[model samples]
Target chain A: MLKLDKVNSFYGRSHALHDLSLSIPKGQITAIVGRNGTGKTTLLKTIMGLTVKSTGAIDLDGTDLSAQPTFRRARAGIAYVPQGRQIIPDFTVRENILMGGFASTSGRQVPALVGALFPYLTENMERPGGLLSGGQQQQLAIARALAANPQILLLDEPTEGIQPNIVEDIQNIIIRLNRDEGLSIVLVEQNVAFARRAGHHFAMLEKGRAVAAGPIDSLTDELIHQHIAV
Target chain B: MLDTIFIGLSVGSVLLLVALGLAITYGAMGVINMAHGEMVMLGAYTTVLASIHLGIGLLGAIPIAFMVTALVGYAIERLIVSRLYGRLLDTLLATWGVAILLQQAVRLSLGLAFFGITIAGLGTGLQNVRVPAYLSGVISIGGEQVSLYRAFIILVTILLTLLTWFIMYRTAIGAQVRAIMRNPDMAAACGIDVKRVNALTFAYGSGLAGVAGVMMSGFKTVFPDMGTPMVVDGFLVVVTGGVGSLMGTVLSAGLLGQINGLTASVSNDIIARAVIFAVVVTIIIWKPSGLFSYKGR
Candidate 1:
């Protein structure tokens, strides 16, 4: 389980995430939904400890991670696939994927899971990541995260800006990882329909605070209109 | 004419050594390390001290100087530069302060000067290292005589540069560094310890500068302020080559060193310096990002 208790995040002097508390159950997909600039990205970054400063508790499993550095937090089994799929452009597809192995206990290697899921990336192992199409890069990003052998996967808008044809493919991959691999996932998604289909739980964020949250069944259309409809 | 070119190659070799560390530190960390030159100065001092106390030769002093200066660089990163990562101007000012402090510490004999005590190989006076007898001799290449020491300098630079290239391209540590260089936050998110890699990178760069210092001590007088102009020259190479580019640093150092050598061969050192400055300024104006700047998507 991943839990944030009264967490406040800041970027230099500007407060980005207000006093926010959330509980993400293990081995399930928890969709974080909100409108643009409603701190969806900030919530993911806060969980990753990428913010300049943050207050309060961030617990992963039984370990306290609020005071840990980003790499340490990663080593502790939290893998973040950030917004924009920030893969190293100059690095080869293989190198980009293996980079996440730095946090893994088994060391740097292409996991069998990646080979099965991202055969295109495996085939173009020597190609530079920047040359890949947007959908391909997003696949490379997910493959990179899986290289960590992480217990919890934090995916920030994984399908954003992806080609329409590849979007469904990426969506299925996310669901498969959670269902088949039994990995706990925190998915920040803009497509409410996709979230409703895939997520077991939901958290509605507005102005950096969780305004409404519960099981996916309780995520009423009224709550969506109130906090996320914009 | 051939001798002048040889001289240029040797001069460029030393400049490459000095600029290599600056390029890495500045490129990876976005830090302008004013104390970088002081590492060179300390390296020369290490040679002096090693010769006087340990009876070590120039070759023997190389590793010692690297270790000594690398440790100092690591300490600086842990204590000061680490704190000033994103603050460009503050890092410049703070490292400049560190440069002065290092120079003063050397001049004062590590605070032994106040008691009117002077170490034999240290203080404000200029010091020199004797070139080995074999190195002092001239070698005939294609019926033209060339200083063996200058040739040795070129050889050492080539070896170290190749070694640096191998480490960066073939090693896991190098991958981490390159990742950080391209995108630090992303690198960290990928589970690379950015701070640890940065500290190691800083140490390695300082070690290169220290080696440069040891080389310089053979041909030039070692003084507290000898490294000051070197810092300027190193920056010139980095700027002309493009920040964070190893190939750029190598090529630019060679270009600037050759320019200085060829001009000084005909005119004076002062004119050669002026010409170098003019060339650098022209290049900057022509291509502000530099000759080999990386283009991102």
Candidate 2:
């Protein structure tokens, strides 16, 4: 569904991503698991057009997305949930959810559809985003991406700040979205066990390049302990 | 004595309008926007020029002035302000340069002579009060007499304040604006077009400033360096009121206006300015972040 060929992204003189290539199959949760500062976020930024300088090809459904801005990339059916689940705190739950509709391809309201993805959001639609606790904000953040109805959802640490119970809720939502909705997902995470649950495929990034890539089954517990357990 | 409060409110209302837009551009956008005061100058000068040169009525001149100044703001942002945006000191200096250019441009074209705008049938005095004399005329609250215009200005300020509050807090665009302000990266990730919203916010903020300029020029004399005088206070109001908070901006402007009006009656106007500037400095040195935050930005 998505392909990156010989992609290199830079932040000033510091090279954040090397000549890395990644591809995702349809209807599966693809996990790019790495320690912090391992170019995982940079990869997502490059795909989302948030990177300042990038040299490579990013194609989604055969349409080149390397030159588009972040918003443009989103309109092209790529939804991203950034690190820390950055919600617009001053905005009400409904407003934050409505913000997701900005990438609505049809230019029509989809409240019922969004409510289906995260019912709690629909329930507390009038409350300010800041008023929600950490876990609830994470749900709202994910629901916001779902509201966009993208072909692929790129989530960066959706479970980082939430409690264990809410983490399970997020995991279940991810499962439902992928299994039932057939939405492609590129999840960047630091937790191995968390990544192992929904991740059907895994790639380990070190320094700035992908050092390992294969199906989730190939990433044995020993390999996970050796590289990602830290 | 009651008339003094009225004077303060009229002055405060103009300050509120001027400061309200500054709250959005500098406060919400983090653009520094030193050119904001200059935009107000552009509007006032545009209004005067429209009335004098084109003989346009005030009604026609209002929207025309708004648009032209908005375009001026848009062009400045696109050509100059946008480039200097990421760098704080650079944006400050660049916008100041734009302000100087605008001021000098007006001086070069129109010269130093002041121009008068005669409102069709409206005179300088408040011949008609919206409320009855007992209600509209200020009673002594604090050893000061407020006049009808000043009282009316306070009421108008409240109304516009509420309107802006509703637009910013309850509406969709308001959410977008606050979203962009809080977390541009998150907002971008969520599919909100940061640049487009930013441009609109800049234009809208400066446009409101333009309206303030139009209203101010009607009350005061229109001169080339008119905006320069208040540019510092504009900064101070935002700082003291807490950066980007609409309520903060209004409160600060009102406090500053009353202090300035009351002080100028007794001491030099500079004393009034010094008092307000002192408060702003103290606030920043103490709590750099303003009272209200568009958090997560």
lDDT of 1 at A61: 85
lDDT string, candidate 2, A20-43, tens digits? 998888789999987788899999
C-alpha lDDT values of all predictions: 0.93, 0.76
Model 2 lDDT tens row, B1-297: 446545666677878877887788875567777778877777777676676567764445557767877788888777877666568888888888988888766655533333453432122222111122343444555666545445544665687678778988877677778777667776777677877777877887787778677666655666656787666667777777877677778877877787777776677767867876776677788878754533453
Q: Interface RMSD value for candidate 2, one decimal? A: 2.3
Off by over 4 Å in 2: A108-110, B57-59, B110-163, B283-287, B292-297
Q: Output the number of the DockQ-best candidate.
A: 1
Query: Which pairs clash (backbone N, Cα, C closer than 3 Å) in model 1?
Result: none
Q: Model 2 has how many clashing residue pairs?
A: 14
Instruction: Give the CAPRI rating of model 1.
Output: high
Q: Kindly list the per-residue Cα lDDT of model 1 for residues A1-230, writing each as its tens digit.
A: 99999999999998888889999999999999989888889988988899999999999888999999999989999999989999988889999998989889888999999989998998999999999999999999999999999999999999999889999999999999999999999999999999999999999988888898999999888888887775
Which predicted model would earn the best TM-score?
1
